[model samples]
Target: MPEMLIDYYKAIENSSAKMLEAARLKDWDEVVRCEGACAVLIEQLRYQSQQQELEPAQRKEKARIMQRILRNDAQIRVLAEPWLTQFEHLFEGQLQVMH
Candidate 1:
């Protein structure tokens, strides 16, 4: 396909959407798994991007896909705040004990 680059972006977006759903469900393990998948997709996208360029129309579509991914990421972060705080506290406690 001429727009294989766009396909990569779409795949990343889909993974991000799944991550968002997992975050909503408070399924941290699932979110982590999805995050790993997203990292792989992002690496693949980066490699593919270096090898190919998107057409002007595909570039626009890519921008839209990126916006949605960012939106999903923002929401996921918001949802994870409580968990992050707890994790930070755990680390802080361990640090205090070590000291």
Candidate 2:
């Protein structure tokens, strides 16, 4: 809602896209870097979520935190889904090879 929150969401979305691209390319190093960035953002979001009282100034900060969390989650799922899919494909290929 707040501009700050919108910024965080944008950052998360960008980072997630990078991570997904890295995974899709099988670039483990890039994936790790993206994952680390996501972890830091997630921590910041968790801290903001714990604050009980938010002032008007803090509203943007809180919104940014929430956005970061949501985007991070979506990014993680994106990264994981491809990995799972790839693994299944590889496993099936191995099975066929064995046969």
Candidate 3:
């Protein structure tokens, strides 16, 4: 059976939530994995959207899901900023060592 548009929204939301959880734990790998999943889901959602539109109720639900996803994303970014800065410094140090 073909996937429903609402299902895609739900899946993306789930991935986003997982990303937030992983970020809270400082598990960057898991966060990356979930981010990848969200990317794939969002791409699929875009394609599926062209082929099918959500019902009015589904559209409302999608809006709610999107809101949660955005909130999760904000939290993830806040948690990740410091880790990303540290990683960037480490990478720069490694490059200096090579030189």
**Top of the candidates by lDDT:** 1
- Clash number by candidate, in order: 0, 1, 0
- Please say which candidate is ahead in lDDT: 1 or 3: 1
lDDT of each: 0.92, 0.67, 0.91
lDDT of 3 by residue, 9-95 (tens): 999988999999999999999999998988898899899999999999998998999899889989999999999899899899789
- Model 3 segments beyond 4 Å from truth? 93-99
Higher-scoring candidate on TM-score, 1 or 3: 1
Model number with the top TM-score: 1
Q: Model 2: runs farther than 4 Å from truth? A: 1-3, 49-99
Q: Candidate 2 on 1-99: residue-level lDDT in tens? A: 213443444566567778867877768789789979877765665565465445676577657656755675576577678777887998997899899
Worst 10-residue lDDT window, candidate 3: 1-10
Query: TM-score, each model?
Result: 0.92, 0.47, 0.88
lDDT of the structure predicted as candidate 2: 0.67
RMSD after Cα superposition, model 2: 6.7
Global CA lDDT of candidate 3, please?
0.91
TM-score of model 2 relative to the true fold? 0.47
